[model samples]
Target: MAGEHEHRDVSGGWLRAAVFGATDGLVTNSSLIAGVGGGGGAHHTIVLTGMAGLVAGAFSMATGEYISVTTQNEAIHAEVANEKAALAQDPVGEIAELADTYIARGVSPATAKAFATELAASPKDALHVHVQEELGVDAQKLPGAWTAAISSFLSFSLGALLPLLPYLLGLSSLPVALAVSAIALMAAGALAALLTGRSPIQSGLRQLLLGALAVGATYLIGHLLGAHV
Candidate 1:
């Protein structure tokens, strides 16, 4: 039972947000660095471009998370509110709805009806069944928008700094950017996998290789464009 609960926790919305936010930070900032490096941009320019990417990407992630999560929260709240109203006005019908939900989930009709009747004997149990079974929602809980915004903003800025640090220390243009981005991407991948309970080695290698390819491809493009210009 404990192990089952742990697995269920891993599938929650918060974990989803954390993975998505971290990945956004890593990929967007890394790609920005590669694009700037490829364009034959100078060290200062590269740093500045990275800073810009950090800010822009952070804001974008926050806004996107806010809109999406808030929309979900509202929908869930509305459903709970409707359920409460229905329970107040039509307790029998609401009990029947809960039983029907259980029946739909493979329980026999008689067993579902008995289970729902027992659940509805207690008001709290009735609400729990209505919310969990009928609505598929956690009625009392909502994701914190402020928390999401702050985490996203901070994660992007932190990730963006990876590419900019070498250039800040007076390292040569392309090589330093490449090296820093590579290390940062690998680290991010490993961290993501750790959080998601996956194989860190595999995730790290995949992300590192992808980042390398992106930077290498963009660098070549920039070099060619620079030569022509």
Candidate 2:
């Protein structure tokens, strides 16, 4: 547990979705704005495109996260219910299974059986123990679908605003917008790495590079389209 310090997580749960939504918003909106500007789009058209990307991206992220988390959570809850049923119908078999689990984890056979017996004396305790051992899920920490959806919506919109704010303020310089976006992405990446015990400087640079690539690629494509299409 030396490296297992508590910090914000953003890999495979609500936190992941929220962080993904925000970082994606920043990179995507910045690229869209850069692409439009590169294509010689008028000021109004550029701003409009950035606005469209922000709104569309936020809603899309929120909707996708909602469906994904809800479906997964429903499946897990169904499993928990089935576990409850099994515990109710076959108390002895369930206790044997629980004891087997503990024994497999290095507990002595007699001690494991005793532990299982004590747990089975209370229905709620047995249910909790069985569910965790069988499913590797913590009932108390199950993620909320609604929370993920709302968090994604808000975080994404806020991130997208970082790149779009300059244009809205009548700043026509694309370089300035890009600079702001790069710095924002670096900071976001560094902050995200804090929880995972990664080097913040490396993470920041990686994010900056990726965001730059996205902008560069879109800008070139937009320029080609404007020139030839």
lDDT of 2 by residue, 113-143 (tens): 9999999999988888888899887765777
Q: Tens-digit lDDT track for model 1 on 1-229?
A: 6656544344335555665666667677667777767777777777888788888888888788778777877888888888778888998898788888878889999999998888877887688668876666666666766666667666766776777777778885666666777777777788778566778888888888877777677667777777777
Q: Lowest-scoring 10 consecutive residues by lDDT in candidate 2?
A: 6-15
TM-score against native, each model:
0.84, 0.90
True lDDT of residue 87, candidate 2: 85
Pairs with backbone N, CA or C atoms under 3 Å apart (clashes), candidate 1 = none
Indicate the residue-level lDDT of 145 in model 1. Answer: 68
- Report the C-alpha displacement of residue 216, candidate 2, in angstroms: 1.9
Identify the candidate with maximal lDDT: 2
Give the number of the best model, judged by TM-score. Answer: 2
